[model samples]
Target: MLFAGIDVGSTTSKCVLLSDGEVAGAALVDMGIGTAGPERAYSEALAAAGAAPEDVACCVATGYGRASWKGADLTISELTAHGLGNRFLFPEARTVIDIGGQDAKVIELDAGGRMANFVMNDKCAAGTGRFLEVMAGVLRVPIGELEALAAQAEKAAPISSTCTVFAESEVISQLAAGTPVPDVVAGICVSVASRVAALAKRAGVKEQVCMSGGVARNGGVRRALERALGVPIVWSAQAQLAGALGAALHAWHKSEGQRGEVKYG
Candidate 1:
């Protein structure tokens, strides 16, 4: 059976096409200001998979805009979808840390690879990709360059602020004080990692930790998070596609009318 998943997030939208529980195609695109992202992403994914919408047996939507998606068979929480997606990719993964555009989450998995507990930072942007974007603008550096720039630092400077606006001002002040750009950028990464680490601790981290979402692409944040959590982190080419992949898996499972352990591909 053909199953599809769409994740419409705060900053981007993603879609995945699955055929008999295996990925056939996927698409990711920026989700600007409207609710049209899911449709666009899905259309692209369908084209890539060489399948029409009528060929899909089931479709599931996830992320912040899941409910607003058109023609979705169902909607699931990002937490559940991410846990499933990560476990599907890494069967040994017991902990998951997802840092998306506007929020971050830490999920603990049970022995059977099901989500057991999770903690999230939804009240603030400090632990998210948005925070890094603001800091990058203040540093006059591209967002994609922050990771490499931070890697050049000898020692990370102190950001000292948990608020996004406050942190931007702190960066400005640090620049005025003649602090190196690399050091300041490294400090911003460390600050974000620290906040996410706190959430992971609250959710009870275990071995074989995996990180997902768009922010997981940042090497500086990943390195700092590994240090803060004192664990080796695992990442994959499919990291950014975790939520949509999991939603597709759920759609397949639902089509079978069973709730049991999923056998990985």
Candidate 2:
């Protein structure tokens, strides 16, 4: 049977398809929430899996726009989804650091891979993808190039402002003052890491920490976070699809339960 999961996040949408409890296909779209991104991702995923929507036995939705999707058979919280997904990717993961487009989350997991505690910073964008996007715009650099640019930095410039607007102004000022672009970019990554590190500390960092979400793909931010938290952060190529994959896992479990063949992790 085919099971599907759709994650409609703040700035991206992802879809994952599971065939007989194994990932069959997945797709990610750049647009999200309030847009056609969710449907687009879902359709593309189904197409990739060579299955029609009617072939799906169950569907689950998660993320910021979960409640808005009318196609899902069920909806789950992003925190729970992240925990399950990260654990699936890294069986030893005890903590998960997920930084998305608009928010950051630090989740603690139990020995059984259940979410024990979590701290989220949804009230600000200072440590999120949006913040990095703004900084990139200010520096006239593409967001995707920030990591490579930061790699060349001799020293990271200081950016003390935590507010997005103020930070943007600060970045502009740094440029005006002739601070190297690479240094400023590195500073932005450091600033983001520092803000999220505080949240992770509040949640209590643990060994076998894993990062899941779009921001996890940023090498510069990952390095900065490693330095700030003083621990190795585990990551995978599937990190960005964790939420959707988790939701798909839930869908599979639920579908199996209905058949009286439920399985536990």
lDDT for each candidate structure: 0.88, 0.90
Top candidate by lDDT = 2
Where model 2 places Cα greater than 4 Å from the true spot, the runs are 257-265
lDDT agreement of model 1 with the native:
0.88
TM-scores for the candidates: 0.95, 0.96
lDDT by residue for model 1 over 136-202, one digit each (tens)? 8888789999999999999999996479988988999999999999999999999999999988999
Question: What does candidate 2 score in Cα RMSD to the true structure?
Answer: 2.9
